[model samples]
Target: MLASLYKNNHGTIAEYKRIFSSSPAEVWNVLTNNENLKLWMDHLEITDLRKGGNIQFHFHDDLGTVEEITITDFEEGRVLEFEWGKDFVRFEIRPEEEGTQLLLKQVLTEITDHTPKDLAGWHVCLFHFADVVNNEKNHYPENEWEKWYEKYREIMK
Candidate 1:
């Protein structure tokens, strides 16, 4: 599903929610574990899994750019929040009666030409994340993302 974008004191927030038919612990492991993370979001690597630690963001381009994103908040098996460029991205996991609820929020200080693209990217990534939680092979659906990007562009307008 597409993330809902709203205004907040911090600026804007893009909130995405997913329900997985897996235990919270299981989902948490897939979310944080480097090996599991590689299956979905290979660009991110948790260099230090703690608040005030770092999460490395890699851009596999000719320049091999890597950014050290600081972990602003962390709660084992519960919450993870980290720096995302000028903004921040947070993940909250909770055990639900059906299984687990994963909440992803991207806090944006300002909306620019790149905002919709980023939102679409996160939407697609979350879909892949669900696949990982379900023990399915991760695959990037570029066509799906393109569809979402158009939707997001309309929404942003």
Candidate 2:
């Protein structure tokens, strides 16, 4: 599904919600654990699990460098929020009858040209997250981003 976008006096906000057929702990594991993380977003790795901790966006192959974004808020099993460029990306988890519900809110400071790409990236990553949690044996959908990118471009327009 396309993330719902809203405009504010300051900028834009993109919100996405997904329900996973797993416990809250399971969903939290996929979000914070680098083992499942690298499969979906190759560049992201959690360096710590505290408010003052950092999430590294690794440029491992080329520069061997990483961009460290500080964690703004955290509650071990419920909420995780961090800086994303000039904005904030927050993930909230809640228990559901079936499993867990994940709510992602991207607090955008501005609607830049790169917004759609980031939105689409998150969209595709969530799909992979679901598959990972469900233990799908099929290969990762490497080509899925292009389709989502197009949708986000239109949505962001």
Candidate 3:
């Protein structure tokens, strides 16, 4: 089962929990490698896969400019954390019966009208993560993210 919760305030926090059908090491590889990331996430350039290594992702397109993120922390087969603008995000992995348990959290430091859009974006992206682990191609819904953000902004008010 997968679940998520979000609270909008000085910062917005979103958390997602799910059980995956893969080992923590396998899942960790998908999460840490830039090549695998390109399959599921925005194009990425990771300097190193060590704790405190620099990480950056680019979503450059006609819609907008670059979306660069920095890696804050990393624990092999366990956890990874990063920052995007004023937002902080983390991914935590644990052992589970069938495979691995994954938890993803994103904290944004500022309550904007964009809260709903942000949450929805995470929702879609997280599901994409699940898809990749399940052996499906990870295709991000960039257009959907924009559309949902508009709808979410309206709902946030």
Candidate 4:
């Protein structure tokens, strides 16, 4: 699904929602566990899992800057949010009859030249995340990522 972008007090909020047939606990595991998290978003790891805890965002290509982002909000299986550079990244989980509903929101302080690329990467990650939750191998779809990048560019413009 495409992310919806809107202005907020701080900046813009780009939110993406997904539904999974996996239970909330199952989905939560995919989002929080270090092993499962690496499968979806390789650059990120949760060093701690509570408010004021930290998450490491590594730049594999850059290798020089490893950001230990502070957790701004957290709940065992319901919510996890943290600083992402100058912005914030949040994941909210809720139980559904079949499985769980997950909302991933990235708070953007500005729509810079990199904004579209960042949003596209997120759209791709969530796409791969759904597959991993279903026990499939992690696959980054380059075509889909390109498509999303163009969509985000048009939206930002």
Q: Rank the candidates by lDDT, best first.
A: 1, 4, 2, 3
Better of 1 and 2 by TM-score: 1
lDDT of 4 by residue, 1-157 (tens): 7899888798999999999999999999999999999988998988989999999888887556787899999999999999988999999999988889999999998779999989999989987798789988665555777888898999899
Judged by TM-score, which candidate is best? 1
TM-score of each: 0.95, 0.91, 0.77, 0.92
| Model 2, global lDDT | 0.87
Write model 3 residue lDDT over 22-94, tens digit each, in one string.
Answer: 9998888878777777666765667667766677666677865555466788888898988866888889999
Q: Against the true structure, whose lDDT is highest?
A: 1
Local distance difference test, each candidate: 0.92, 0.87, 0.73, 0.90
Whole-model lDDT, model 1: 0.92
TM-score of structure candidate 2: 0.91
RMSD of 2: 1.6
Q: Which wins on TM-score, candidate 3 or candidate 4?
A: 4
